[model samples]
Target: MLYALGDPVSLVLLLLSFVVAVTLHGWVQCLVASRSGLRGPAAEGRTRPDPRRHVDPFGAVSAAIAGIGWAKPVDPPDRRNRGALLRVLLSGAVANVVVGLGALALLPLLTSSVGSLVTFLGPSRLLQSGIEGDLAARALLFLGLANLMTGLLSLVPIPPLDGGRLLFGLAPRSPGWQKAEYQLDERNIGVAVLLALMLIPLGGPQALLPTILDTLAGPLVRLVTGA
Candidate 1:
C-alpha cells in the first residue's frame, strides 16, 4: 500500500494516527470488559491504552491500506450474561465515535480547514498520504477520520464485526438462526470474506468497504466540524 504512496512523513503520520485510533478502540473494549466483570482483559493487562496490548499486526496493516480495520478481539468472560457481552461488543464502536468527535472539536483550534482536512482522505479514501497542514493539524485530522470510519465500519452487519455479533446475539433463538450463526462462527466465513473485501479490489460494490465507510462518515464530519 505504501508502495504507491509517498511522503515518508505523511505515511508515518498516517500509521501513527491509525495506531492511536486502533489502540483506543481496543483499549476501550478492554476497559469496559474488565469493568463489566470480564476477567480476561483485566487479568491480561489489556485494560490499558498500550498499543502492544491492542493492535493486531495484520489488522494494522489492513487499516494502513484500507482505512478500516479491527483490533484484537476480546475473549468473552462467558456466554452466561448476554447483556454484558453485548455491552462489551458495543463499547469499541462508541468509543471511536467519541474519539472522532473529540478530534473534531479540537481541529478548529489548530486549522481553519477542519472540514476539508479531516474529510479529504484521497485515492479511494483508503488512508492515502496526501495530508497537508501543520503536524498537530494533520494528526488530529487523520485521527478524527480514522476513528469515525472505524466506529461506523464496526457497525456494519457483517460477520465478526461488532454489529454482526450483536445481530447474532439478539437474534431469536430459533433452531434455524442458531444453527446458521453457529456455522458462520465455526467456519470463520465472515472474517475471510471481510478480509478479501478490504484487501482485494474485486471490482464490485462489495469490495469497496473503505469507500463506503468514507462516504458514510465524511459528510457527517464535514458538516459538524465545519459548523
Candidate 2:
C-alpha cells in the first residue's frame, strides 16, 4: 500500500530520527560527565549548553551531504578527571547502542501493524500501488541500523572516538600510558578524518551496510505490524 505522502513522510521521519538520536547522544554525554564529576566547558566559563557551542561546521555539512555527522569538541574541563573524561566520551556511543537495540526490538511490531493498517484503509489503487510499504520498511530499518553503526563505529580503537577513551581509561596510570594518551589526543583530528573518509561508502542508499540494516529491520517491522 502506498501512503499519500510517503516520500515526504519518510524524509520527515528520517530527519526526526536523526535529531532524536543525536539529542540522546548529547544527553548521555552530559549525564556521564556530571556523574563522573568532569567539569564541562560551562563549568570553566568557556561555553554554554547551546549545541552551537559544539557544532562543527564541516561535520554538519558532511552529515547533510553524506549522512555522517559529528559534534564540535568542547574544551575538556579544567580539572582533568580521567575517569570522568572517559565517561563523557563513552556516553554518546552507549546511547546509540541502547537506541539501536530498542529499535531492533520494536521493528517487527511497527512493520506488521503499519502494513495491516494500510491494507485495511483500502486506499485507491494508485495510492496503494505507489505507497510501497517495502520502501517504508527499508527506510526505518536503515534508521535503526544507522544508530547501531554509529554506536559500533565509535568503539573503534582510534583517537578521539569512544574506543580511544576506553583504552586510555583502562591503561595503567604510568608514564608510558600517560604518554600514549597524549599521543592519541595529538593525532585525534587526523584519525577522525581518516575514519570519516573510510565510512563514506556506508552512507550510500544501495550500500551493503544499508542493505544489511534493511534486512535486519524487516522482521521487526513485520512483527510490529502483525503482518
Candidate 3:
C-alpha cells in the first residue's frame, strides 16, 4: 500500500512540471507559427500559458504512463511557407530542451548539497527517495529530467513527431519522398511504431522509453548540474 501511495508530493511536482513543459512547448510553437506569418488559432489566443490551450488528453495520459508524450497539434495556416512550417515544428522541441536546461540551472538554488544532487541522480536512489530532498530542489530536478526526456523524445523521427515533420519539410519535392509521406499519412503507421517502441523493453530489464530518457537525458542533466 505504501508503495502504491508513494510520495504524493513528488507526484504533484512531477505533474506540475510536465504541465509547465507542455505548456511552454505549445506556446513556443504558437509564437513561432504566428511570427512565421501562419496566423490562426495560436494568434487567436490558443498560445496562452494555460495547459488547457495545449494539452492533448491522450498525450497527457501517455506522458504519465511513459516518460515522454506530446502536446496538442499546431496546425499551419497554410503549406505555402515551408520555412515557416519547419520553424513552427521545431520550436516546440527546442522549447522543451530549453525548459529542461533552465530547470537544471535552477537546481543549485534549491539545494546546493552534493548529497542531495547525487541522491536525485542515482537511479535506485531516485526511485527510492521519492520526495526526499528540499521540495524546490526535487521539483526542479523532476522538471528538468522530464522536460529533457520529452524534448529528446519529440525528436525521434516518426510521423506526427516534430522530428518527422522537420524531416518532411527538408525533404525534396521528389515523387519518392512525396509517396513516402503520403503512405505515412494514409496508414498512420508512425504512431503505432512510436507506441511499440515506448512499450517494448530495450534488451534489458528497463522499458525502452525510460531507458532512453535516462541514457540521453541523464548525462545532459549531470553535465548541467555538475553532479
lDDT of each: 0.72, 0.50, 0.67
1-227, model 3: which lDDT tens digit per residue?
A: 01213778876766776687778888888888877776685556875777889877656755665545677767744445777877888788888898888878778666665334544553222422345657777777767766776678777766667777667667788999888777664476766677667656678654665565566666676677676
Q: lDDT, candidate 2, residue 180? A: 73
Report the lDDT tens digits of candidate 2 across residue range 1-227. Answer: 11324466544554444455554555566656655655664463323344444444543443444443445433333324665666677777778766766665565754654444433432111121223456656455445544554555456555555566566666678999787777766756635553355344565533333234334444543453456
Q: Rank the candidates by lDDT, best first.
A: 1, 3, 2
RMSD (Cα, Å) of model 2: 8.5
Candidate 1 weakest lDDT stretch, 10 residues: 117-126
Clashes of each: 0, 19, 0
Worst 10 residues of 2 by lDDT: 121-130
Model 1 lDDT tens row, 1-227:
26326666667767777788778878998888888887888788898899998887656767766766777767644556887878888899899988887886787888787665445543235355435558887777777777777788778776667777777777788999878767665677767777777877667543577767767776777666774
Clashing pairs in 1: none
Of candidates 2 and 1, the better by TM-score:
1
